[model samples]
Each structure stands twice: as structure tokens, then as C-alpha cells.
Target: MDELTSFVALGDSFTEGMDDPGPNGTYLGWADRLAGMISTHQPGLRYANFAIRGKMLQEIVDEQIPLAVGLKPQLVTFCGGGNDLLVPGSDPDALAEVYEIAVADLRAAGSEVLIFTGFDPKHTPFLRSLRGKIAIYNSHLWSVAERYHCRVVDLWSMSVLHDRRAWSEDRLHLSPEGHRRVALRAAEVLGFKPEDDWSTPWPPLDNEDWMTQRRHDLKWAREHVVPWIGRQLRGESMGDGLAPKRPELLVFDGLGSAEAGEAAWKSAHRA
Candidate 1:
């Protein structure tokens, strides 16, 4: 309710900032964008992100949660379980049990928690199959937020994200513009009026015929989907041997340009 002096973000690639590439070739997704907005109001807000590209729910609970607890930030945003839900036989009910424990831990540590639902997958041809599972998991997330009194940013209801333009070429992570809109949504959830509105409609585009759509899907399947399946078969992850981008709750001022943001990121990494 009061000014959020510090924040920590935890989850997988979505939070790790995939397709939304920053200058210096790193990802700067919604969390970084949100941090910048908060700093505009608080002036010296401290923030950290413990998200990697391919983490599962259990990994986030076991690894990132404790670190987030240690930081004791005023706000901590939790988004996990999408990766687990993508697994062939994962159960949403069981995932929520583990998810609740992490929520409990953060709440007990006296931080206001912010949580997110998985973005609606119905628009993505390859990911549409997981819609039911994601919906089930999202229902559980809503219940968890209710029980813990946490703030929620309902990604599923954001009609803007259903557009093809909001996604990256992989049909997975959000595009830079997509992340920008999400940050604006998160700001609104926190009761702040952002500079831009998330609900603004995009300019019109020519419709792709069925054959053209099929060709694009096939190309994406070869470049992205097949390799993802191979990784699952061999028990490997894209984030293997990688570390959290922002491990400490360092101060964030939210630089304007990608170049400026990258310079600050490098300075932070050097520290």
C-alpha cells in the first residue's frame, strides 16, 4: 500500500526476460520495466531478479524463494509453474501445493507479494494444447492469492497479449513491446498510473492466408519447437549452468534507452 522501497522477482524465462532483448544483448522484461516505474516514484528503489530461462516450479521454490526471503524486499513478484505445466504429466493441484508454501514463506517474511497468471496460450498454435492445464493452474493461482492476500496481475485477461504481434518469433516469450505493455499492467495493479496504457489497440495489419500461416508455423517448429523437444528427451535445459541475472537487491533507477539500461546492467554485473 505504501511506497515500495525494494522488490525481487522470481520465476523462469518469462521473468528472466527472453525475447525482449536489451542493449548489450541481455533480456530486460516486465520486471525490469516495472522496477523502473517504481523507481520513478520512490527514487532509489532496490530490486533483484532470480529468474532463469528453463526453471521448473520446484526449482524456483527450492532455490529462488530462500534468496528472496533473505532479501526481505517490500515487494516480491512470484511467477512459476508454466514450465512444470508444460511437462507431459504434471499436476496443477500438486504444483499449487508447492506454490502456496513459497507464498506463505514470503508473506511470513513481511513482504507484500505480487503474483502473475500464465499468459493465455490459445493464440499460439504450438502452445494452444496447454490451455486447459494453464487455466487449471491459473485458477489455483487465484485461490493462492486470495488465501495469502497477495496482489495479482492477471495475464490471461489481458486481451492485448492474444495478438501475434505481442509474441517473439519463437511463439513463446513476449516481444519487447509485449513486455512494455505488461509492465504498464503491473504498474496499474500496484495502483500507479503508468505513462502508457496497456489496453491501447494496435494498428491494423494484413491478414495472413491459411497457407502462409502454415508455412510460418512449420519454420518455427523446425527452429524452435523441435530443439525444445530434443532437450526434454535428453533431460537438458537451456539454462543449464546459467545463474540469476540480478542476484542482489541493488538500487534501480530505470534508465530510458536500451543503451543506457545495458550500461547500468554491466555496471551492476561488474559490482
Candidate 2:
């Protein structure tokens, strides 16, 4: 557990940071937050993010993993297969087999690996149906982490994430607040001492009417769910023709957590 000075992240939209936008409207997800935390101790930290939205697990293995291996960063975070498990008739058992090869590759290349389990999706509206599938994949991820001696972010056991505020309107990505908490958790996983606690509960809120809730669900389905289904049917991906935004392991513009730290982090990205 030496202080990891170099890091590479590989994943999909979740790692690309969809809903957690920076001040200039760029995505600054948990990875950057964790980098910022690490930089406090390891100022020479160099980081790269190979995550893109809508990337499948195989795509990540084929494209991103090789690049990461070449960089030979001290640590690699692999968190894909979510988009894979979401497809109808997709097999979690089969996906886990593919996932292990990627992890094994990273580990064999002399880099420590970190992996994330799927979150508990029961509280999510349309995605609640995929709960059992997600659970199955999460179990496999846990076993993989154990067998490979990799660090676990364990997103499934993150109780604070169950709150509605932790999710974006699309219900697939984390909100800014959700990203904040996740960064703290990631820092904890890496043994970095974050200033805030991720498990702190939010203040109580008033409930909406049942009819209003129904209307919101319908709106979500029409806007987000329908488009997602169409893309799946068409074999299209949001990451189609898109390259990794942060391809190199240099000083990422926004790489910090906490309120003041986040402001500075966003400003760095703006430069």
C-alpha cells in the first residue's frame, strides 16, 4: 500500500462522469476527486481517464485496457460491464468471465487494480427491474476482487447512495452530490483521509403527491428510457465516434473534492 503516485481509470459513462459537471460544464467525476485527494500527499501524481459514455465491457477491454497497460500506472481502476448487464438477455456470469481477463491483465502488468461493484438499483424507477441482474454481477465482482487481491469500491454496500438525491434525473448516473460522496469513498478505499464523511445522511424532505410521482416517472421513461432503448435496438452508442477526453496521464485540470477544493479543481480544468 505504498502511496500511489500514478493512476489510470477505465470504464463507461459512470467513470466518464455524466451528471457531475464542472463549473465550465465539463464532467468531473469521482476519479478526479480521488486524484485530488491523492495529490495532497503525492503531489507528483499523474492521472489519465479512459472512460467514455455508453462503452460496453468488451469495448473497454479491447480499447482502453491496452493503453493503460502501456502507461503502466501504479494503479488502474476498471469499472465497466454495467452497460453490458443492462441489455435484455445479457448474462452476468458470462460478462464476469470477460471482466476477469481485463483485471488479470492489469495485475500481470505490474499495476495494482481497483474495481467497483454495481450499486443497489432497487430504489431506481425503471432500472429497478434489473436489480437481480446487478446483484449477480456484483457478487462476481466481489469474488474477482478477492481472488485478484484488488481494492474494492463496493458501490453496492454504500448505503448513502440509496437516497433519491444520489441519482441523476436520467437515473443511470450519479448526481454532483452523489459524485462527491463517491470520491470520499474512493479515497477511503485507497487509504486517503478525506475531510468529509460519505455516509452522512441528508436532512428530511417533504414527499410529493402520488400522481405527481407517476407523472415524473412517465416523463423519465419518455425522455431517457425511450432513447436508451432505441440506441440499444439500433446498436448505437453515445460514445460512438468519440475519443477519450483525457487520454494522457498528465495533470488533470479538475482533480479535487470538498467545496473549496472543488472550486479550485474546476478552475484548473478551465485553464
Compare the candidates by TM-score and give the number of the best one: 1
lDDT of 1 by residue, 42-116 (tens): 778999999999999999999999998988889999999998888899999999999999999999999999999
- Candidate 2's TM-score: 0.93
Local error of candidate 2 at residue 77 (angstroms): 0.8
Encode model 2's per-residue lDDT on 53-122: one tens digit a residue.
9999999999999999898999998999999988889999999999999999999899999899999988
In model 2, where is the ten-residue run with the lowest total lDDT? 262-271
What local distance difference test score does each model get? 0.86, 0.84
Q: What's the CA error at residue 206 for candidate 1, in Å?
A: 0.7
Task: List clashing residue pairs in candidate 1.
Answer: none
How does model 1 fare in lDDT?
A: 0.86
